[model samples]
Structure formats: C-alpha cells, structure tokens
Target: MTEAALTISHLSIHDRSGAALVDDVSLSVPRGGVLTLIGETGSGKSLIAQAVFGLLPAGLSVSGTITIGGHESIPASEPKRLAALWREQIMLIPQEPSAALDPTMRVKRQMALAGLQEEAIKPALAAFDLPGSTADAYPFTLSGGMAQRVLVASALGVGAPIIVADEPTKGLDSDRVTQAIAALKRLSAAGRSLLVITHDRRLAEELPGELAIIRNGRVVEHGPSAGLLSAPQSDYARTWLAADPRHWPRCHRCCDMTSLALSAHGLSFGWPKGGMLFEDLDLHLPKGGVLAISGPSGSGKSTLGDILLGLRRPMAGSVEWGGLDIVAMPSAIPPLRQRYQKLHQDPITAFVPHLTFARQFLALEDVKSGLSAARDLPPLLERLKVNHRLMNRRPCEVSGGEAQRLALARILLLDPVAIVADEPTSRLDPVVQRETMQLLRATVDQQGLGLVLISHDQPLLAAIADEHLALGPRA
Candidate 1:
C-alpha cells in the first residue's frame, strides 16, 4: 500500500460557545490519491479543511491531530507550525474566489506571488482558457467564473504536494468544470495528494477515490467514491444524491407573458480595453416570467443582467420597464430602484463587511412605512432555511451559502417588482438549492414578479427557466 500523505485522527472543532462544529472525525489521503468531502453547507466540511491548514478563525477551539509528511502536530497546540507549510507544501483554493483574489493586483502578478514563475504565468492562465489580455486585468474586472479559474490556476501552479480546494468549481460552466477536473486528475497522476471539499456531486464523482459524507459535524458515511455514490449507505447521503439538479423534476412554466416587466432593444456592451462582449442583443422578461442567460466564462452573462436592471448602460440601446426608458432615468430613485433589485453573485460584496446581518437588515428603508421594520423577517428566514443565530454574526463570519440565502431574503423583504439573480444559488448545497429555486418560482407566480437569472448550471436552468438565452464568443 502507498504511504499516507496526510492523516487526521480524532478531530473535533468547537465554536466560541463550546458548540461542536466538527465532531470526532478521522480521514486519510494517501500519496497520489484524492479524498473528497461532500456535505450540506455549514455542515463542518469547510471547518475541517480550515483546521487542516490551521486557518480557523480566532475563538474557535480545535482538538485534532494532523499528520503531513510524517510529522504529526496538534492543530490547537501548533497552529504556526502547520501554517508554515503553506505554499511550498500545501495550498488552499478557497471557497469564495472573489474574496481570495487581490482586487488591486493584476492577475499575472498575483500568480507570481503565489510562487508561479513569471514565464509560467501565461501558460497557467491559458490552461484554464483565460485570454492573454486577462493577465493585465484586475480581479474586479473579471467575471465570477473567470475569477474562479484565476484562483485555481494560481493555487495549482505552485506545485504544492498537497492541495485543499474548497468548492473550486462553484461558478464554472460545464466546459470549464471539465477542464478543472482534468487539471486535478493530472495533479493526482503526478503523485500529489488532494483533499477537495465541495457540494458538487459531479466533481466528487469525477475525482474517484475515497469519499466521506459529512452531516451535522460527523462523518455519516465513508467508503470508496464509486460504491458510495452509486449506493449510499446512510439515509442523508441518499437524500443528498437525490437532490442533484440533474434529477430535479421539471418546473412548469406558468408565467403570464401578456405584459412586459423588462425589455431591452439593440443592446451593445464592451470593455474599452477588451473589445465587445455582446452586441445587438434583444431581450424581454414578461410580468411573472423567468428568463435565464447562460454562457461560458467571461462571456458577459452577468453584464447582460446588469443592463436589463438599469445598473449598467448599453452603448447603443434602451432598457424599458413599465414602458418607461429606465436607461435614461437616474438609477437611485427610491420608487424605481426599490421596484428593481439585484442578487449579486458574490454575496460577501453585497453588504457592508464590518456590520452584522441584523443591522444591515434593520437599516434597509421599509418601502411601506418609510421606517426600518424587521417584522416580516422571521418567516422569510424560516422559509430560506437560514438560522436566526447567523443574523448576529458579521458577513465574513458566515458561510457563503448562508450569506447567499440572507441576500435573497433581504431582496425579498423589499418586495421588488423584478429581481436579477446572478448565479444566486451557486454556493448553496444541492438540497437548499432546490428549496430556494422553488421559493423563487412560487414568489414569481404569486406576486407577478419578473426574474432574470444568469447561471452556468445547465440542469438548474433546464428545470426552472421559461426562456433561455445562450451567449457565446462574438463572430
């Protein structure tokens, strides 16, 4: 048998209140093997990965023995020693690519700082299909998928012996996801050990090795990936696998298309430096309609949604809502602005980082009474499956999926006439994703609200969308 590259035994983690987050879990990754951890959001999957790298937040206590390269260390006792192994020995591809990337630095520069040689940077980006010009662009300018690829490229280029990728394919399209999997397979083939944490069953299935199904802070199922995924032993694992979007029941399209909620004509947009993304595009979202936009990374799916919402200007077109040219009106007017809302792809950037969620929710101007009232908040939280305790924590403290649900809840509270959701459920687990999409469909049906969705998830789009628009490279 091949020697173990990394081993964890009797691992447990606790939050500040002495609540166990990860409970007595043990796992091993042999050299040249891949180990995947699949579970629901906030089920301690990320906590385990954080503990492995000694990057857990302050006030969280850990009791764990992590062995790497034959050296064993207690996580709580020797955090610095574990952290010292970063870059050269182990690298982490974080869950939120936007937060992990440096906003001010160019892409190539960031890769170089990650220990990728200058000459290798171009080839690395190219491997992910990133354009040559992307090397000079700042992180803020890249699409969510582009940013994710950049992070993956940077981390993998460091040649670390062990890699812990947390939701590495979160926002990628089908093609890009396949590319990522291929890259990871190559790494394992070259004798590097990988510990991947994700909610994506497709990713788990592709990286066949050891699979551990975690639930409520414990390893409920552990076995070979092929056998377990094909026939899970635990009830929770069965439910999770069933929740895959591929198996989702097709949603009936019941929207009234008689009247328009949003429309765009002769739309054209492009970056000054990168040339045009899309042009002469026309779109319509009827009252209570669902229009989904899909495309490869950096194809401007989100940009199109932004144009329809009046958040951005198309170079040569007009966007109309309720027969008024919203493109010509000021975007900040309360009446118009409140009627149109957006759910950002990166929920972390959607709120003030320093403030708690409760404060942010309370600060929203109540459209009905012109006062901040959180009276309707409880039911919304319950419907979204968000715990009330999370409201007290700051944005950075919560999981990405939790923050996404909160963002949706906040938008729902406004009672908007339309919502432009940019990959809103990408961070959520499969089960929660189905629930949230169902809620959105119900809301649209009941309130006659229009929805403009941008996603790379083909199964999800197939299950939910009324009309689909696919964008691609300009001819």
Candidate 2:
C-alpha cells in the first residue's frame, strides 16, 4: 500500500450538551489516492471531515490524532498549530458555500483572504468556467452552483497536499461534474491525497478512489472502490449503490396531452452585460404533466423560474396560467397563489426561520379555510411521513430531508394547480433523493397538478420528467 498522506485515529466529536455526533472513527488516505466517505444525511461524514481539519463548531469536544505526512501528530485542541497547517498542508472544500464563504464580502475579496492574488483569481475562475466579473459578485448574488465552484477554486488556489471535499459536486451540472472529476483526478496524478465525502455514487465511481461507507458516525465498510461499489458486502452499501439514478427504473406515469396548465410564449431574456439566454422560447406543461428543465451552471434555469413566477420581468413574453397573465396582473397574486406555488431548492432558507413548522402550516391553512384545515393536517402530515412533534420545532432544527418534505407538505396544503420545483433534491442523500422524487411523482399524478422540475440532475430528470426542456448553451 502507498504511504499514508493523511490519517485519523480514534476520532470522536461531541456537542456542547454532551451528545456524541461522531464516534471513534478511523481511516487513512494513501499519498496520491482518494477515499470517498459515503453516508446518508446526518450520518456525521462531514463532521468527521471538519474534525480532521480542526474546524469543528464552538464547544464541540474532539478527541483524535491527525497526522499529515510523517510530521508529528496534531491534537484537535491546538487550534493555532492546526491553523498554521490548514491551507498549506490540508484544505477543505465545504459542502455549503454559505458556511465557508462570507456573505458580506465579494467573491474576489474572499479568495484574496486565501492568499490568492487578482492574477491567480482570474485563472482559477476561468479554470472553473466562471466569468472573471463573477469575482466582484457577493455570495448571495451568485447561484448555488456558482458559489460551489468558487469554493473549489479557492481550495485549488491554496495548493494543499491533502483535500477534504464535502459534497463538492452538489449544485453542479453534468459538464461541471466532469470538469471537477478531471481536476481532482489530475491532483491525485500529481501525488496529492483526497478525502471526498459525498452521497453521489456516480461521482465516487468516476474518481480514482476506494470506498469508506460511514453510518451513524462510524465506518461500516472499507474496501477497494470497484469491487465494493459494484458488489457491496454490506446492506447499507448495496442499498446506497442501488439508489443511484442510473439504476432507477423508468417511471410509469405518462404525460397528459389534452389540457394545458401553463404556457410561455415568445419568451426572451438577456443579461445586462450582453447576450440573450433564450429568445422567442416556447414551452408548455399540460395538467398533471412533468416538464423538467436542465442545463449547465449559470444557465438561466432559475432565472426562468423567476420570470414564470412574475418575480422577474422578461424582456418579452407572457406566462399564461389558467388563461390569465400573472405577469401583467401583479395584484392577482393572493388568489392566483392558491393555484400556483414554488418549492425553492433551498427550502429552509425560504421558510420563516423563527416560526415552527406547525405554526407555518397552520398559518397557511388558516389562510385557506379559517380553522377547518387544522382537522385535515394530521392525516396529510402522516401521509408525508412527517412527525407531528417536529411541527413544533423551527426550520433550523430540522434535517435537510425533513425540511424538503415539510416544504412539499406546505405546497400540497395550498392545493395549487401547478408547482415549480427548483433543484428540490440537490442537497439530500441518495435514499432521501429517491424518496422525495417518488413523493413528487405520486403527488403530481394524484393531485393532477402541473409540475415544472428544474434541476441539473439529468438521470433523475430522465426517469421522472414526461418531457424535458433543455435550456442554456442551446438557449
């Protein structure tokens, strides 16, 4: 076996209140090799990566020995020493850009903090296919995929010998995924070690690596990448592998061609800088039909959503919903919302942070039926598999999966004639992804609602969408 580049022994992390989030887990990545740590949501995979980098949250207890190269082992308690080695010897590609990036700072300024000069930033951004001007944009102004690429570029900028990428492929499109995989492979070829923590099996299969399946904060399976991934010995591994979109069977639900639920005619949009995204674009979604829109990062998919929802004024075009032009009648939203709703990609951010899930649901129900909807909520929440007790907790307390389901439940309560979901499952685990898609398919069919699924998840779109509208480059 190759000599170890990064190794962790008996690592454990606990919350301030004494709850153990990560158990005694141990793993190693050989020099120039990659090891993917796979796990379901909340399985503590990212937490382990944080522990390795000595970036755990305040008041969390950590016990471990992290050794880099043949250097002396470093304990988690020595923050200064670990900080010294952080960028030069080891680096982290965080899962959520919101966490790693400073919202107040411009993207370029943030990269500068990592010791990247303007000259360095140009090449790095270009390498990731990001525009040079993107450096001046704030984190919130950038798309999720754009933010993700910024993080990747910063990690590469640091020239670390060892990289821990947590869900590095999240929010990326197919072309972007290919580029990221190629970049990581090149790094490995150049003798750098990588610890990739993800729930994406396809990405894992493509990267040069071994498999380390983590569950409940422990390493449950560790073996050769090809063999273990192709024929996983453990049930968790097998189930996870099967959840890949490639393995999913065709969805049986067919498209209904008779009635039109939504129509966009003569649509045209252009960036302020220059160039049009799409012009005279025509699209339609029949009642109870699924229209999946897909394309590369920065491609106008989400922009189209905003236009369709009347949130953005298109250069030219009218979105007709039930023969009414919502774009022209901004005052009609109150009643029109009953037949139109949106489930944003980051549902938690869309939710009222201070309000409990129950209160949020109740408030919407009250808007619909005074107080009668309260009697109907329990059964609906049960059908969605949402715990009643969780309703009392705020959005921040729920898992990503839970928050997504809750968002869906809220939309269902609204009884909309159609719903536009933008990358709804981008942040979920494979298991949750499957479950969420299945629920969406069933809900669309049963409720006879129009569904516009906007995502870069091609396999998922292929399996679920009745008709896919390709956006971007072609746009």
Candidate 3:
C-alpha cells in the first residue's frame, strides 16, 4: 500500500493549565489528494496545524505521532529537528500573509530564499493569478489578496510535497476567493498533498477534496466533501450547512436617505509609484444609507475607505462630513474621526490588544459608572452572541467572530453618525456572516447612520447595499 503523504495518529495537545486543546485526533492526507478541515472558530483546527508544524504554545504538552511522506513519526517536542524538518519538508501557508512576509524584502528575493529558481517561481505566480511584476513589489504595497497569493507562491517555490494552509482565503472578496480556489486546485492536480483548514464551508464544498468536521477538539464527521455537504450526518454539520448564506432568508432593509451624511467630490488618489489609482472618483452616502464599494483585489477599495475616514488624505478631493469640509480643517480630523468610525478587515488589530473587552467598552463612554455599564452591555453583547465570560479576557483569547462583533459594538458605543467597514464579514463563517451583516444593517437603519461597506463580495453587497460602486482599472 502507498504511504500517506501526511499522517497524525492519536494526537493530543494540552495547555499549561491542563486543558485539552486537542483530544486524541487521527487524520491523513493521501499523496496528490486534498484534505479539508471545516470547523467553527476555536474548534482546535489551528492548534492541530500548529502541532503539525511543531510550533505550539510554550508549556503545552503534546502526545502525537506525525509522519510526512513515509518518514517515521518524530516527537514534536524536538524544536531543532522539527524546525529543520519544517523548512525542508512541510511548507506552511500561514493565515495572515501580511504578518508572514518581511515588509522590507522584495517578493522575488523572498521566493528565492525559499530555494526555487525564477523559472520555477514564475509559473506558480501565474497559476495563482499574480502578475509577473508582483515579484518586484514590497509586502507593504500588496493588497491582502495579493499578499496571500504571494505566500502560496513562496510555498510552491519550496517544492514541498505536503502543504498546510490555514484560513488561506480569509478576508478575500469573491474574486480573490475564486482565484485562491483555482490555485489550490492547480496545486493538488499537480500531485502535491494539501491540508486546508477553514471556517468557510462554502469554500470546502467548492474545493475538490475529502472533508473532516471538527468541533471542540474532536472530529465529529469525516467523508467526501460532496456527500457530506449534501447530506451531513452530524447535527453541527447540518446546522452549519443550513445556515449558508446561499440558503439564508433575505430581507434587506431600505435606507433612509432624506439628508446628506457623507460625500467625497473630485477624489483623485495616486500612490507614490503606481501613479493614479483612481481619478475624479465621486462617492456619496446619505443618512442611513449603505454604499458598498466592490472591486477586484488591489483596486483601491481600502484606500478609498481610508480617504473617507481621514486615515489617509486624497491627492485632490474634498470630503464633506455633514456639510463641513474635512480636508479644509486639519485639526478637526481627529475629532471628526470619532464620529466617522472605520472597521478594519482584522478586528483584533483594530482593538487594544492589552485591554479586556469590558475595559475597551468602558473606554468608549464618558460615563464612569461600572454598574450602569454592566447593566447596559450584557444585553447588547448577548444580542451579538458574544459571551460575557470573554469580557475579562483579552482580544487574543477570543475567536475572530467574537472580536469582530465586539469591534462593531465598540463603534456603536461611540455614537458614530457614519461608518466605513472594510470587509467586516470576510473572516466569519456563513452563519456568522449573515448574522453580523444583518445586525449591521439593522444598526445602520436604527441609528440613521451612513455606512460605506467596502468589500469584493458581490452577493453580500447585493444583499445589503442600497447603492453600489464597482471599482476597476484607470481609464
């Protein structure tokens, strides 16, 4: 019998406090085949991946046998051996590309460091739908999707037979998501083994692979992707499938656009090297209106959001906030920003990492009454499905969905009149995505606040946006 490309037998991992993060799990990825792990946030999917890479948190106890490509199982505790094996054998496509790449290094040099020739790297770049010029660009200049593709390219350059990608398509728009799926498909077709971990069941369903359903550190279900998605046996899997956005009930709220809220006129933005990203672009979001900005990756959606929120200045334009020209008043920018909040793609980074959720919430308000805050915050927290138990813990201790909802709650507490949410639901599961967007939509209407939703998701935009702007290359 042919040996599996990657195998984990009776794997268990425990935290310092003796809590089992991963309980006795067994899985395998056959050579040239794809295996996907689908689970909710905090279900131990990432811990499993970390275990395979021998990069688990300090003080954690691991009892596992991990074999790669017919090699004997190596104890995961040996850091030097695991580090060497990791570099030479198992290629990891990390969750956040921006964090993985060196900001100072050129993409070409980084790929070269992975031990691949330019000839070998070019095709991989092309396969991932990245331009040849991407190799010459700095990590800071690449959009989230572009950076993600570069990471994939770097892994492919190493020519490792086994690839482990964690949330590879997280925060991408539909276009970038499609490109990522295509790239993964191409990689698997070329006889490389893949272990993809994601919360996006839609992504799992679309990929050509077997599927494993994990919940609370256990694999509850395992089967072919088609069969599992079509008729999931487990209750959690069935609930997850039923909650997919494609099957979600649609009831879009109409925005009240009786008065002007925010507007940008003659907006012309140009990067230092890229020249003009957009010229004379006009945008308007009325009171209680939603204007979704949709575009391909690297097409300046986030840049436009930055300009609107005063985080970045446009080359030539006037942004009017409630009839006041923000560009004309530099000193007022800071105060006005409080009223026009921005929600980033990664909510955790948007938060104060050192502060607990309760502390963060208190910081938003002028009222110092703890009793009042305790009485007021829980109902809203419950509405958003954020556990009150997490209030004591820092942002890093919470899941992505929880962090995102907490961020939204924070913005709402500030009593903002307008909001610029950049891909707010991109990292959440389908159920959470629907819930969060619906909640956001309801909040916008209830507060009569203007919302500029920037994303690449056409279906999501269509579902909630009252107005749409499609961005593309310059004329």
User: By lDDT, highest first, what's the ranking?
Assistant: 1, 2, 3
What TM-score does model 2 achieve against the real structure?
Answer: 0.88
lDDT of 2 by residue, 39-137 (tens): 776667877887777777565688888888667888866667777788778888887787678999999999988868778998989888988888988
For candidate 1, the TM-score is: 0.95
**Rank by TM-score, descending?**
1, 3, 2
Error of 3 at 295 (Å): 0.5
Q: Tell me model 2's lDDT, rounded to 2 decimals.
A: 0.81
Tens digits of per-residue lDDT, candidate 3, 1-475, equal 5458999889888765577768899999988888999876666887788888887756578887888777778776655555677756788898767668999999888889877797877787887667787888999887877788888777766778889998888766676677778778878988889999987665797888789998878999998999999999999898777766667555555655558778999998877776677989887898888899987777888889988888888899899888888877767777667788988787888888787788878775563323356667777778777767668768765556667888887777667889999988866666667878888888888888889999766777878888999888522
Count clashing residue pairs per candidate: 0, 0, 0
What tens-digit string does per-residue lDDT give for candidate 1 at 356-475? 898899888645455444678898999999989888778877778888999999898888888999999898888888899999988988888999889999989999889999999532
- The 10 consecutive residues of candidate 3 with the worst lDDT sum are 364-373
Best candidate according to lDDT = 1
What's the lDDT for residue 228 in model 3? 91
How accurate locally, in lDDT, is each candidate? 0.86, 0.81, 0.80
